[model samples]
Target: MNNEITDSGVATGLAKILADVAGRLAAAPLSARDPLHVPAVATADARVRGMVLRGVDTTRWTLRFHTDSRAPKARIIETQSAVGVLFYDREARVQIRCQGTGAVVRDGAEVDAAWEAATAFARRCYLGLAPGAVTGRPSSGLPDWVEGVRPTEEQLLPARRNFAILSVTVDEIDWFTLAHTGHRRAVFRRDDGWRGEWIAP
Candidate 1:
């Protein structure tokens, strides 16, 4: 019995070390030119098709992504705030899945601040037609307003109606690590105030 307990302790310690390494790898920045530097939002469609929507991480716990106000996912979010965000590092073979509730920021300084940080290219996604509008075949291409015009900061200021900010509050995180010895899984559940513990990896 004593030997079994010792073996379990050692395994748990190794799992903790592996989990730490994996977490750091997933949080590390992507390549200088990699567009995925920002966090990606995972949304589930009717057929369970998982779509990753990329967005910038405002801070460690907060992420900001802009979607057309008319997008179907926006409405889905409004009705159902629960979501899952997956962050993984292939080299490290570590993946972190966060399940949480999301809320849309509508007014006040937070919305204004998010708007200020948005790039012209990002803001361009909301211009012209509404989200999910039908597109008919054109002889040439999309109109000049859609294809040619890029909105300046001034042009985007009043267009806030089409912009939205989603805030996800993480409640649980599942950490998985792949190592030569074996696979390790740890589930971290939030406790009162601030505390966490590793259970059965």
Candidate 2:
């Protein structure tokens, strides 16, 4: 996820749509660090939240994200695995919707690696109170002592337990683009070997 892949520029074929989707998704985690890197992840219960894109494996069509194991969405995903991800590149005028099954892995080699890769400052979040926990007032949930400071290794020990990795296996992709002349749209399904079909925009 290090190499930046820029837009390939105006494309109009189904094959191009598939290739574009793959290329964008593959590079999202590595390069685009704003809106594209923070796609909206929706669960079965109609809950949606922006999550940082951690990695993408186009060969397997799987997306990786980091989440707190104590978060309610983590529990929801553990039970109802069906999920959808929406990615939009406003500058490129393209939107990609992905349907898939998600899993929250609280402990494993993958989880461990993700946690270890996170900066001490980034890892400080897991050390905070559980997400959605009712607080007396608006709060970051982080301890005052750790605020604006990177925690040491010893301070990050407990946070590791709350760290988890979310992996989504994409099954379908709907690609769309807006333009002055006309809009283009297409769909690709894993069940059909990812063969894309142009659809009415």
Candidate 3:
């Protein structure tokens, strides 16, 4: 996600590998806009929805993604903060699963700062009239301007009201690697101050 979550030693190394794998897949050829390249986010009600990997904050042990406040997953977090995110890249044979507390930020210093960092393309994601909106017709329901042309920063401004940052403050991380020689598995936890272990695959 944003700049690859630079870090150090084991933690940094592992995060970098995961980021690289996800990046490759996310960058693969597809439509102008595709959610297939994104990872999955699990809500409290057992709903697993796709979401782009917006950013990763390794220092804070949190993963970030942008979404509409009206989205079902967004509502689920308001009541149940527990959330899970899964990242898997078949080509790289790596899977990164994280369980964490969910936080919905609509307006705040963090939100503003994050929004500011978003590129025009990134901000374009929020161009919909309403994410998860019910419509009588079959369509993406995104505003017309988004499909025809790149909305200017001014046009993208209204999205701020609907834009939300779903930040996952990870408490645990399960990493698995599938390999012919030998599979590797590990678990990292924030409990008792950041504990890690090599577990059986």
- Considering every candidate listed, which one attains the maximal TM-score? 2
- Which tens-of-lDDT digit does each residue in 1-201 have in candidate 2? 111212234233555667767788878888655558999999999999999899989878899999999988989999999999999999999999999999998888888888888889899998899999888988999988998888999999999999988899998888889999999887777763665666799
List TM-score per model, in order: 0.69, 0.89, 0.73
What's the distance in Å from true for residue 58, model 1? 10
Ten residues in a row with the worst lDDT in model 3? 28-37
Which candidate model has the greater TM-score, 2 or 3? 2
Give the whole-model CA lDDT for all candidates, comma-separated: 0.56, 0.84, 0.73
Cα displacement (Å) at residue 45, model 2: 0.9
TM value for model 2: 0.89
Worst 10 residues of 2 by lDDT: 1-10
Worst 10 residues of 1 by lDDT: 1-10
Model 3 off-target regions past 4 Å? 1-37, 119-127, 143-155
Please provide, for model 3 over 43-129, each residue's C-alpha lDDT reduced to its tens digit, 9 standing for 90 to 100: 889999877766665557677777888788888999999999887767678787889999999999989987888787767767775
